[model samples]
Target: MNLSSSLMACLALAPLAQGARLSDRLESAHGRFLDDRRGAFTSLSDPFGVPPLAKIVLEDPRGRFSGPESWHRNVVSTVFWVGELPSENNPTPNTASAWDGNWQANFGGYDHPEKRDGFLPTGFVPALNPFYIALPYNDIGRDGRHRPEASTVIPWFWEDYRGEGISVCKDRWVAIHHEGRVCYAQWEDVGPFETDHFQYVFGKDAPRPNRNQNAGIDLSPAVRDFLGLRSGESVEWRFTHDREVPAGPWRDWSPEPGLPRR
Candidate 1:
């Protein structure tokens, strides 16, 4: 959605209170935030033009969309919830451990070959690069081998869109695998310009879960059919594994010619 429409929808959800001043500091921070890495692949014409971060404006007492609140003022206050894994190829332990605490706390958890010099910390690894750090989340502690389920809010960054040159927006919800790796998925809505609508670009060779090997598995077809998607449509998706059932028994649409209909 365009800025105006998005603003209108946010306003409708929670209106701004009277006399509330927009935080200049927050605005400045957002303006300076980098949307994508310098040399990352993307499909958008301007990868950096999108805001790397967004302030979550809560409704004011007056029920109007007005100014910034304390939550929005603190740049690091943004939070995201951990969703289920998307593929059967479970990530290794190293992948899941990285998302244990406040996402910002684990900034430098991963290692990379090409390092940039600047505001980023010396040991920092960009979470956007899934090959390095899997997903974004906060950890409770580092004592045990247990994988706990908890929700947290923290500063978030986006990866450069592959080939499209666009970057994922911080406002969107992301999926996190047990390995700590993360991926972006969009929600369904009325149209491309709708308030809840989002655009996403998936990487080639992305993993697909085999819930039912007998169902004739192919991620693209399953995802397309599951989301009621159209050709060339962009979407946000997340996968859930049903361990209770056998992988081969799952039913799915066939993409190949002469394949049995499921």
Candidate 2:
């Protein structure tokens, strides 16, 4: 997102006003640029004789967005812990992940957001990054066989795939947006309900119907706390490149056990 020169100029001078109704003052300053002549001052709203501010409209500078920003908007998300017990909606305990059998053991303990020690479970620090998420697609099937469409459906499957036992989707970064806050997390497991929904996960199709309020993704305790998200909430998410993920708590810990922080 880029800002116009006039709008940028007004925002750059926002700190000039310093009293009551701060938002109104800022708005007044912003309004000046929109209402007044191009690069010209009109009225004295403050001691500096600067015009009132104008409304700032955020937009793409090129009038069109790039193709890669395929965000899954307004998708229902649910909270799931590393060692969560089995529930009615989720029949399997999260102790064992679809990829890693020793998921809970590898994570160090149950990642209880309510009983936490700063984004991790109380008692022990996780061996890997606590910031994790589960999309509704697993490249590997339950029968210990890889999905036939995995290579074609997954965007970077060919470049990242190691072998049969390994998963390319595991540890993939995802950016989740709620309201105005954005939280980044790694893909560690699969399912709020369905997996193998390649159309929704990779293409333009929406999520499939499910019992858990049509949940499309599963968030970890760390991700939940970071975004201030409830168990059942709507959020927008998109797959993000590892290098593109900005420095945050999500990068504070290692993605692999014994490896350096990512």
Candidate 3:
């Protein structure tokens, strides 16, 4: 269904401050789904009900995101794009991943650079990976379902949106809102931490173990740089449907078949 005239006006301009607070949006762009006819951000605070979006802070878990071994469930990055690697040392690692692996194809068909001796170049992982987006997912099934594995080589974490009957997708579009900049990126992967935390990502309640780390979302190097997020910085973001996405690197990059919904 189309947005109501008033809502459209609000979306075109700045969202109203009184619109139902989610994270920090003065006004969100919550619309009524044509299928279910349910308002996206319906809140009890709104007498008319249903605000647009929420402006809550997101987490850029770069430093404190720790784990035991390479496969140790908690220390991986959620993305695998090739870029300068960020480490937790006084000096930054002037290095990047040699390979940009595919998530759906099991990291298949990639040009792996030869490792310098047994030692990974300056600041890369043992497998020669410069960096990884540590997500809370372990799902390694080809069927697009959640299974949750712990192998760094498994390349398994993209969950089946349809498995849970949700609409999230790999490489899905998202709008990240910061101090005043609004950067756009694809949902390349899930998490800086806590993958199964559905309520935090989509539902009304905030993400878990938050208030401390306050990590609800993870951004890739590009996304983080675009939004200018500091390590462990908080920002607001919302999922943008395919139809609403604008054309950019996120839209024009390599063709993304994406994970099977069902």
Could you report the Cα RMSD, in angstroms, for every candidate shown?
A: 28.2, 21.3, 22.7
Ranking by TM-score: 2, 3, 1
Tens digits of per-residue lDDT, candidate 3, 1-262, equal 3557655554555444676455334224434222123345345455455676988744332222122221111211122233324443212222321112334133222212232223122333322121123233323333444334322122222232344322234444456667687665655444444545543443345556643365656555545555555556666665444445555434434345432111
- What is the C-alpha lDDT profile of model 2 across 116-203, one tens digit per residue? 8878789888887889899888899877767889877776776676888468888888889998999988888888777789998887
Top candidate, metric TM-score: 2
Strongest candidate by lDDT = 2
TM-scores for every predicted model: 0.14, 0.70, 0.39
User: How does residue 125 of candidate 3 score in lDDT?
Assistant: 32
lDDT of 3 at 185: 64
Lowest lDDT 10-residue stretch of candidate 1? 70-79
Instruction: Compute the lDDT of residue 151 as modeled in candidate 1.
Output: 14
Model 1 off-target regions past 4 Å? 1-89, 93-135, 144-226, 229-262
Q: Is candidate 1 or candidate 2 better by lDDT?
A: 2
On residues 1-262, what C-alpha lDDT tens digit does candidate 1 reach at each position? 5655644444444424575445643443344332223234466666658766678754222211122221111011101112213334332222222323343333334322123233122364333222111222212224422213211111121121222212222222322221222222221111111111111111112222122321211122212332343333332223222221122212221234333121
